[model samples]
Target: MSHPAAELIARSNRLGSDARNTNYAGGNTSAAGTETDPVTGQDVELLWVKGSGGDLGTLRQEGLAVLRLDRMRALVDVYPGVEREDEMVEAFDYCLHGKGGAAPSIDTAMHGLVDAAHVDHLHPDSGIALATAADGAALTRECFGDRVVWVPWRRPGFQLGLDIAEIKQQNPQAIGCVLGGHGITAWGATSAECEENSLMIIRTAEQFIAARTAELEAQGTHPFGPIRDEYAALPEAERRAKAAALAPVIRGLASTDAPQLGHFTDSEVVLDFLAREKLAPLAELGTSCPDHFLRTKVKPLVVDLPADAPVEEVVARLTELHQAYREDYAAYYERHATPDSPALRGADPAIVLVPGVGMFSFGRTKQTARVAGEFYINAINVMRGAEAISTYTPIEESEKFRIEYWALEEAKLQRMPRPKPLATRVALVTGGASGIGKATAERLAAEGACVVVADLDLGKAQAVAEELGGADVAIGVQTDVTSEAQVQEAIAAAALAFGGVDLVVNNAGLSLSKSLLETTVKDWDLQHEVMARGSFLVAREAARVMIAQGLGGDIIYISSKNSVFAGPNNIAYSATKADQAHQVRLLAAELGEHGIRVNGINPDGVVRGSGIFAGGWGAQRAKVYGVDESELGQYYAGRTLLKKEVLPEHVAAAVFALTGPDLVQTTGLHVPVDSGVAAAFLR
Candidate 1:
């Protein structure tokens, strides 16, 4: 049977994948219970955000940051309108970044205001189709009708809140609203419901666009056209210079707390498209949708930096341009504000463009930029299509500002709180001082588990255990789990300290570089002793204690991907891990009678700054593999489906699943935490 968490994850994945496949840069899911707002000390559960810059496939619980809604509402009510907006943005950003969590999505306020159990935001291609058109609101209304409400495009931040509030007051039962020329937003009492609505909106938009495009094509009109020579001849040097100058300015506008900056310049096609005169009028018309304003911004900033300008000079000019823009923005705000209006909340720009360089969408978070980039790319295509049909007509400028600056829209910035899933568990991990083991230890502790760290490095183990600061909860047990006596002592100490052993994670193992043919008996025995014998010894001993207490517990073996897949030089290590996997199955089969569960979590090469794949897998080892040192990690990462290195914490989550109530009926199972590398090798 599938675990509930696993089922939720599987379904969540489908939603996230569909969003990205449709051209959205990213998507997120958030949760909350009644929580006290950190800023206002009010009683309300702040929803948890999945955060920016994260892909759903690898996202774990830690990625979701909490925000206290009551506190947020208090801040909104207590502070000046302008100050409240800034505080909301700051508080949300702080909850995301300052709390050492992934940055929350820029539209967190939108999710908060929905007063729903779950929320999801995305920029689907179909949605972008109508959003990029001049008659987006009319088109959406004709298609979605009462199912969706249309919010005019706003720049985002404070303006977005203002717009959303207006819509809510008008339609109390509205499921969600689409921002003209921006993306779509959906909310529900559960994650499944939210996802369903999101899909409904996207599918509806797609079907509408498909039919409309087909009709146009039948009439001998195409949506997009090929780029002409005149539009494509922009110099690359000018583009490069433009990106160099804009990086810092873009970074500044995105976050006040984050001083770090990295720039990814655009492709030639993107730069060429931005250089067109049609770009200005199209941008003034508004975004493909309003929510997209938080991602791509209402429009891209056109830089006129010359190709011959020095990189430094170009950067300086970009900074100056942003300053001028901000001053002009203040003037625009003063000109438009009424007694009821709130001033601008954040400095994030819609999009920044250098004459020859590509565009950058500055938002409160990376997810914002990511989604905006997706919308921008789609919008570019829309413009090309529009040129094919007639110059792309988009929503009006004033409406865009209204949506961007909506009060209710800005309210989406708050986040909700969630309970730790592993709050009462006690975890004992072997090899917990360094590498994958250390990372796993940290993860378990962070999830509210009492962790006993056992390692060969007594000092490191003691330090980590002590740092955890729960004398009764965390302890350092220096023991080579390969020795039955040592393993028993560690198990005994855990029972004595934490009351009982709830989990035993056998993660102690080491790698050797010798090939199967060249392997020595000594090396073979060493691997067997630590990987196979040690795991069995620890599991049996822990199982005995768990059985006595009459509380079924979890015994997890940290196996390796090599256990299932054969490779040239990993014979000794692979054979031992393979045995460990079998041991787990046997333990689960036998110990289930005793109410003890056994499982395994197999991990791929967990190399990132870890002992396993560090130093190019070490120069000496690389020489034996007959590959360059630099190619070692890449060679491994390249083999994975997602091209992402499997981290130790990824394996820890598998351990959590194997041990948690979610997998109560599951036993003797092996979960491959590899990035589909096993399947790749099998194929």
Candidate 2:
């Protein structure tokens, strides 16, 4: 009673979950089955393949596009000569088995041509290492012997499908075909057989590379070295500063025709590859396979890292380097493009490599940018594997051009869904380990912004980040906002990990419940130092980075209702809150011309998860109110007209509204998030 398509979905998910097998929607799987047509009351043959832009790991029934096999097979003869990509697409569109289904993958023709019940096509790193080498066909023959078919590079379309079908017919015993400069296709009567064969081929390649790497290492010639050692040797602050300075430069340079989202990586593998003496040549050999053209482009831009230079000087030098890279890309496109090729897109580099710092990947969305980063890391391994065995050889320039400019490939990008409102933007939250800060960070990330959690407790900050999301969308930085140096470093870390600072939530504060006459100078100074001085430093540094990016941003300070309605015996906390509120207005006036909006949130009785309640201030205030500590939260909630307890989430909502598009034109405003505080309402 098991469905054939279910097996394909399960096996596809298994392959997609492993990065060694594929990276971000790069691989696909399909199955053939017979189903009774409800309308026609007749049995029909169908091909269920992964739909366009669907992730196989999370794929479901709806994610598969069902096509009529007979109708699809008929199109093989319709385009007898060089296949017209557009006409072929139209043919597939008309061959859909049902009225409503996901768009079929561009490889639908290739999948239908295989005479098997199950098929899996994947772009594994090990497979790509062999597919792109000059002697790739010979290597394929050696690994799988006669069981594999070797197809020369062809643009992936009708012609490619025809060639594959011809090869299968010529050698009926072959289990799979390794497409030159493309990927591997393994098919069998069952999904298990297909998966086993594919993994076997991949394992064989991995063993070959390991033996070759060991042999090369014995000769004292390494393809890559431990550049992470060099990176780790530098002071942590210096490392962050360099990465921050370099990320914006690379981002600005890569944005030739449009703004790009850049992220820095210093993983051991990435740094090791960057540290090579002849890295420029190795990096310029182009992508390892044709499928990667859309993600990594043809080649990455390599620029020198002036770690000690001022940011302005570094930006100037990088600008010149990027200009040259753009010109070179344009020339490369012109040399290989045919008369009928699609019009060229802009010449922005998708990846940027800095020797002393790290690698940076650029894209329109954070997901795309992260994928580019992943592909580059995989490319390094593929190239290394090739060099260890023989010489590193990539696909020819002309073939790379065909794939990069293919109309079918371009359509994939065009079909991508629109990004979320805060997509590609970065946010920083101080004291984000708990309380309102933690809530704000989570909210921003949910809206599609990369968040940086900065707190004095590094472990707590890191834990909070992990809970919200991993390092991809959220990172943790240990920061003492009271220290200027720490504040600057924290901002740099945010900029380095993400592209730049687009939004900042200044929420780090402390409360002391001593009477004005009994409060010591230390208590007063401590409150002012953290609330007033800390806010000033974080805002100043964040503004610098925002101005440098030439993008307007949002800055929100977590002030308190005490700023307007000071209770007896709370002078230190009340005075500091009032000072910060005034500072917000001043900052708003100064930063408005630069597109920066400064705002403040004043909340009352936010006892849950708040440091003021957790740190015994609530107990002291409860005593003054002649109530137990447990009753203080309810007492304050009841004081508001709404009689609703204002939790940390409520304050976070206010912060989002001010920073989001709804208040794009509003600034220098103090929003109340205290469940309708009557006395503290803004005039």
Candidate 3:
């Protein structure tokens, strides 16, 4: 790349793409290069730095903050002392080359004040493990032998940047240094050399941690303490089964302030950490790196109970633990808050740990939740290394609280875009691969709900899910709703993928238009089994999840007009529809106390884009109505009060309307989306 900004981006992506180098949006890179001044036509030095909140792994030109090196470095002349360092961030805007590029971050000063042409600030877990050690400064001296210096713990700001600059000037041979209780920063004469230095720091830290761990193991004094037999991970199937059961309960508890989407992990890193005897005390001390703290909160909610205990006992204990966690979090806020500090944003732990189960992380979106989990894994790595090398010692709680409640961070949070109507909600749609089910999946995904498209056709279901937005926003699960086990599996899949089910759409069905004389016993059983029994199975399983969540929920049944209207030659299908209609009433009355709203949509002959119609059911219905198959939709439209065909999208819209913010109080009510069919209207 000819431009300095492009070069910085290339360098940043190379460094940030690897988890060992840095995590998502957790590092900053800058390049000091010459660029011609637009107004003066003279060569001037410029600083191209990774901006605040931009992920270096996927960074673009717009994600870099371009600053006039002369102007940015000049801020030090009048540098307010460490007490007034936050004011320096605002000063950075005045040093910008133009009113473009991403906003400068807190580390801008660290990069600009340094004399090197290339600089990188990163939070590699291995590097941070050494940084948070009790003897970090002495350890840094021993590790690099003066080749890399150590900067003692200081909250990152302009002053910290100045301190690094002074250290660099004094030590000409140093390639980089570990920021005590923070991360690492490296500098070089060129971009390649800077990247090499960054990688060397990371690799060296990893090697040191590994060798030290082995040494400790040889001495029979490993960092995490002996593996507790009682805390050993359960079998994979049993562990995940327990996770699925506990997900809803954890999600509901975490959603006390605002509803949160969740992500679960049983990776070896997590399982190993949880299986150790020292897990509780180490977790309570909290993570060291600022990046880890931001995503994972100050500490986690550790489930201090037996992993193999009965589900009921475990659940009851979780409730007590959850209450204690909230109270402690509120106390932390109260102790640290100034009059101007933002109100306590939340009282829930973003990370939750269960011995023998794994980790659960919650956030406003799937990406956030998943990233939070990833960061906690990084934290585990950090804690392990710190314990192996020296006693793990994080920054003081006061310093952590100050940074956590920093006004600048609050402003960033406030600036985030408003969430969509169904944000943080997860939905499972049966038969979601096509027809009204497919339409509902798309609509819910568009409204910001994580969707699970469950259908018998796995390929089509996966395709629909991909179209909605892959694994992050949606996923596909092959399910035969008629089978109780399959229905349970589908619900479990949704719980595993995105915490718990907040809404479920029972739209999987097949119609058989046969006269009583023509319909055989086999045909009758199949229709009732797929439609009536299937809906019951799905509802029952989803209700278990919903009740466990204690967050209340929505279960919508796509019952048909045939449920109330007597359509000819439709015996089994019509009877199944009637069964579904009454189920809404029964479930609504029963589940109302749990805050679950059961509703139904009666759409009259949604022939266009419907799986039921495409699979030859339309031809049979057309023969009975005495109309050609091609004109069946028109025929159905003509019978309605309003001469408009009822398409699958109309039914999809009814499902959203019932579950969305607008109809929170409406339940056991069937909304007709058949373009005003008078005969099918509820009486």
Best-performing candidate as measured by TM-score: 3
Error of 2 at 152 (Å): 1.4
> What is residue 580's positional error in candidate 1, in angstroms?
54
lDDT of 3 by residue, 19-40 (tens): 9999888989999999789899
Worst 10 residues of 2 by lDDT: 225-234
TM-score of 1: 0.40
Better candidate by lDDT, 1 or 3: 3
Clashing pairs in 3: none
Residues 1-683, candidate 2: write the lDDT tens digits. 57878988899999888887776788788989999999999999999999887787888889898999998998866775674555787688888987636788777878898788888888888887777767888888887788887898776777777788788888988888888777788888888898987787778878877887898788887865434333222344665667786675566556657766777777877766776765778888878576576788989987665335565676777788788988999999889888877777889899887665677898876667878888888888788877766667787888788778877776776777777677878899999998899999988888878899999989999998998778778889999999999998888777777777889999999888989898999999999999999999999999988887777789999998988986888999999999999999999999999999999999996888887688988988988888989888899988888898889999888988998768899999999888887778787
Sorted by TM-score (best first), the order is 3, 2, 1
Candidate that would win on lDDT? 3
Which segments of candidate 1 are over 4 A away from where they belong? 1-13, 19-28, 33-46, 52-58, 69-79, 82-84, 91-106, 158-173, 225-375, 382-683
**Predictions in order: lDDT:** 0.64, 0.82, 0.92
Regions of model 2 farther than 4 Å from truth: 36-43, 98-101, 209-241, 255-260, 305-315, 330-346, 389-393, 396-402, 456-464, 483-489, 589-594, 622-650, 665-667, 673-683
Query: Which runs in model 3 stand beyond 4 Å of their true positions?
Result: none
- Full ranking by lDDT: 3, 2, 1
Give the per-residue Cα lDDT of candidate 2 at 356.
Answer: 58
Model 1 C-alpha lDDT per residue in residues 1-683, reported as the tens digit of each score: 44323433554567766543245435556655554446666665556666655566555666666665665544445445644565556566544322636566556676666566676666665665565566667776888887788877655555465567567657867777776555677767666687788788887766666676678778875454333333343465544433433343455443332211122437654666655655556655545455455456556655555445566676667667767766665665666666766667644455666555566654322334445555676667656543442346565655556655666545554343343555545578999887777777777777767788998778888888887764634778898978898887787556444434667889988767678788899989988998888888888777765654444578888887777887667788889988998898788889888777888887887766465556333564567667787676676678788887676778877777777658788888888888888552422
